[model samples]
Target: MTFSAVSPDEIAQPKPELRIGFLLMNHFTLMQVAGLVESLRFAADESFSSRQIFCQWEWMTCDNQPVTASCGLPVSPTAPLDFNQHWDYLVLAGGLLEETRNPPAWLLDAVREIHARNIPIITLCSGAFIVGNAGLLDGKRCAIHFTTRDEFRQRFPKAIPVIDKTYIKDGGIISCPGGTAIDLAADLIRKHCGEMRAEKGLQYLLVDNGKSRSTKKATGEAATLLYDNPAVRKVIDFMRHHLDSPLPLSEVAEFSALTVRQLNQLFIKNTGYTAAVYWRRMRLEHARKLMSDTDSSIHAIATTCGFSDASHLVDWFRKQYGETPGSFRKRRRDVEKLVKP
Candidate 1:
């Protein structure tokens, strides 16, 4: 299928500029900062022209000192912290060693002053801790990386922390788990710029369709089981939870509040697969994950993934991947060894 090209007139002209400020903490994750920045940069201009007509961003530090990322790359700040300019959003780009790095007094003051002016505060990754510490996150729903959920909850009891979400926009405070800053930037661009611009930004970045905050999971597992329909989502969730013991189609249909025929029709209509086929694909996906991440024997892996026996697994694995389980494992190991430094 071919996608329609966006014409010059179809391209949206940047209007009502959105200014964003980034507060980079020491040892911040580069992926988070780059994802947000690059997505916004794509949305700021039409197509690939690198113009800052729509969105403008500034990188700042409390003391105007250079900050090192978690990956050991150092970045110099463009300016010292100042609230003189009107900023649509103030993002706290958090670091890997969040527990050790405390927000200095000046940073906390800046946060409070920005909050007082009704500017939205966005926390990327462990940056939630900084806003939480500044009392900006009190009594607000927030999102944080799953690794930091428990500690964040204990540290800030008043703030409601949600782990099973990519991002949350509660009033003026927007919180996002790390590595999903691209989605957050796309959402902002969609709201401010236009859907076309957001689509262009994601296309330029080579990101697939964006995901909503509700579809995310705490373990950072892809929410592939989630479907747009509630009934379909319920069935998918049931199938995923019971992957260790395969459930019959009749029972799966009942859980989805649909008859077997209705379930089949729904599955085919939405996902182009019958319920049984979809369940089999999910099981195969689980088996592939086990094969790649664990050292389980074929028999053990088969049973754990709801296969009847080793032969049954081998038959299906070969049919799906064009290789037996043993051969696939060996090939994967060889590739890993060759790529290792």
Candidate 2:
């Protein structure tokens, strides 16, 4: 179909003075940091006239020391992390949350100080752990990596955790699951700047490349019975649709037109887990999402995820994660504090 195009004059320009700082720690993910920098650089280049994108930027490392990425590559920062200068936005980009003991008091103070002033902050990947540590996410809605979602939930039951979304902007605090760094930056550019500049920034980054984009199904409902196997897929689809209230193994087997033993064998063969185990895992996944993304009570979460009670959920979670759900959520919340919000 043909469509009308808007003239160049109608496109909005980005304001150039927005300062974006990358808070680098040891063993940071290089790709995520690079993605953020490149997106901003592209935005800056495209909006040079307005100077609204990249005029003010800095890579602030802990103690101004040279940092190493998880991949063993070294990254030298452009500036020392002195919380003095006024920054418009800050990003906590690192993967060393598990080892960040005795964080410099200044860094914590700076985050708290800056966030108290209402500045925006973004955390990528495990950096959410640092942000959570900062205590800024105590009652805010945020996103964490799916791999780390369970840990995050057990740690911070108060912080609302979202599922599946790459990132979330709850007021001034922006949290991304990481890896999808470009999406986070693009959202920032579009929100604080403009959609056109964000588009151009994407183009500058050559982000419309293969494997970087996902093929989205037409609608949520379109995925109701997506697979071709009428019986097995039907049971799978039902489980997917009822993640908040998962069916028992017997019910699943009946729905799939198989006996319990037959269904169990087939599921184990296909997914490397028994039917009950797979269903529990699926329910736990939904529970993890709710735990990380919502303020729901543990009791409610347990029931929603098809557990008999909170204790049952906790027992399974601990067996799987080596920690209680509450502790895990708190740990992630503690990490989120590292980002300046």
Candidate 3:
């Protein structure tokens, strides 16, 4: 049998070597730390990385002693910190952020030192606070647990917290709301490698049915965004995936195995709105995206978003944004031009 030689470019790009330094301390969430580690493991699986797995890591603590997580899991560092070599990524993992009064001086010093050396820093969940203490997030986009998002903003006025996102990556400071650490890990894999490996990792972890990093809420704050409840999340996911042909409440209720009354109650309790109201808001958001991103006519956008007509969409648009869709698009485009120029 004859075979052709595969060129260097044709082969999968050599996976980038990764040295993830975990700055562990008391009360770090076990799942958060494990999720990140396991995702990398899955990336190394041939099913994911296409036989090019290149990542190595170790745990490090500030004191070089055994660290116990908030969930009572114990871990020991593989080595002590050495500042000679630059790290690929430095991740700080911990919990009880609101209660952590004073971070050790060494942590601050290490963060500042590594940061000055131009290493990318990442914070998990409440770990963002420590990153904030080091002043790395100043004037950078980041993510924090939604529960502390307001306070994070108040404390670090220069750091932008994306309340609606699962993570934020700006200026080499990657921050993810850690309450959903598994999602955060998946996101990190997607960043360090690519979606193919991330997807395979998710599959290996049995999280393939979960939403993509973009679609998942930052944390349990799904209640504030959509509605707090598993049923609501599922229903909203269904509707979003079928925006052009939304299922009726009856069908949604059936899918969720809940009666109409129960579903309505849950939606109301979580979002202060009924199922009908939530669906309308979802459609409106969809309409907004279509209007801003495409030159489709008002009628076309309205029909696509399940509105009765353009007039119906215009009424809702004006009610929500204080302007007509056309005006909103024009204003948004002007703003985009100004920012780019």
Candidate 4:
């Protein structure tokens, strides 16, 4: 029998790791949708080539109808809703309290049918109320914004609203606050693809994300973010920018207009870590990225990441990652070599 040979490059076909369907609600938040879609888009491609190889995302509606957003931008659906079509997750991104109230009866039925099919659903911002209205969020913990908590409670008494967390996944329903969809997308990419691919998107988006959700040790409860707290975000940004020159917590606290104790409390409450601890972790994350992407020596990388010296970085690196920087770099490079043609 005669057969034609297939090159390795050809064998590396485009098999997407995730198939996500976005179901937009009327008067949805355009910023949230755009951030989420762009995050997945970047993760789907290689080096921002914009190909949907790693991840596949589509905008779908009940009858291929166009949905208008709160920002006055209308998006035409790419396909009609098909329950039989397999999807990794279905995202529902709706707008404020007024927009979410009195949602179309069909939309409610659609979520009920989606729940019946055992498909996971992701709710963004006020989208929580939509699922709550359909009785899907009953007896389940969900994340919602503070503004709508009172009404959501009165509307759906059984559904417990959690406002502090950026996102929470109780069983099949994952709910996130407004504008945190990008973080959710990055996390999904990390789950199906890998950390590096997720980081690629975050890095390009200029997301500081020193303690990315995917890398953190899972607590029984949901993880947190700095989106709602400007003070903490400012401090985190300060730490990221001055990675090569470590600063005192008191100095950072002064810049944030909060006392040392107050700053530490904010950091602990938001990030699950004290300011000093979070700063150290952030430095370690930077060191790891440098080890993976650069050819700098240990001393140079240590100094660049604000470590006292090579020994100091190695000590913390081994403590956190359970491997020396040299060992980690070697393994990563070995994998890359194997994947090359």
- Per-model TM against the reference: 0.57, 0.53, 0.53, 0.59
Q: What lDDT does candidate 3 reach at residue 261?
A: 93
lDDT of 3: 0.67
lDDT of 2 by residue, 1-341 (tens): 11122234532332233567788788877777777766666665344342322334677787787778887887777777777666778888757666443356677677777677656677777766666667777766677777777878877777777766666655356777766477666655554444555677676666773423331121112222122234545666778777666556787777788899998776644334576876787787667657666789989999888888999999998875467889756744543342213
Q: CA shift at 258, candidate 4, in angstroms?
A: 46
Winner by TM-score: 4
Tens-place lDDT per residue, model 4, 157-183, is 998788876577654688887754677
Name the best candidate (by lDDT): 4
Task: Please say which candidate is ahead in TM-score: 1 or 2.
Answer: 1
lDDT string for model 3 (191-304, tens) is 445567667777777874546544444432323332334566787777777676656789878988999899888776544467777788878877876775679999999899
1-341: candidate 1 lDDT, tens digit per residue: 11122344533342323578888888877887888888887876655664555676778865678888888887878656777767888988887745324777777787888877667788887888888888876666788778887788888999877877667765357778777487778777765555666677778888765343232232123333223355766777788788878778898877777899999988765444788987887787678767867898889988988889989989998886568888877765654443234
Query: Would you list the clashing residue pairs of candidate 4?
Result: none
CA lDDT of 249 in candidate 4? 78
Candidate 4 structure, TM-score to reference: 0.59
Query: How many backbone clashes does every candidate have?
Result: 0, 42, 2, 0
The Cα RMSD of model 2 versus the native structure comes to 17.5
As a TM-score, model 1 comes out at 0.57
- Where does candidate 2 have its weakest 10-residue lDDT segment? 216-225
Q: Which regions of candidate 4 are displaced past 4 Å? A: 1-13, 209-341
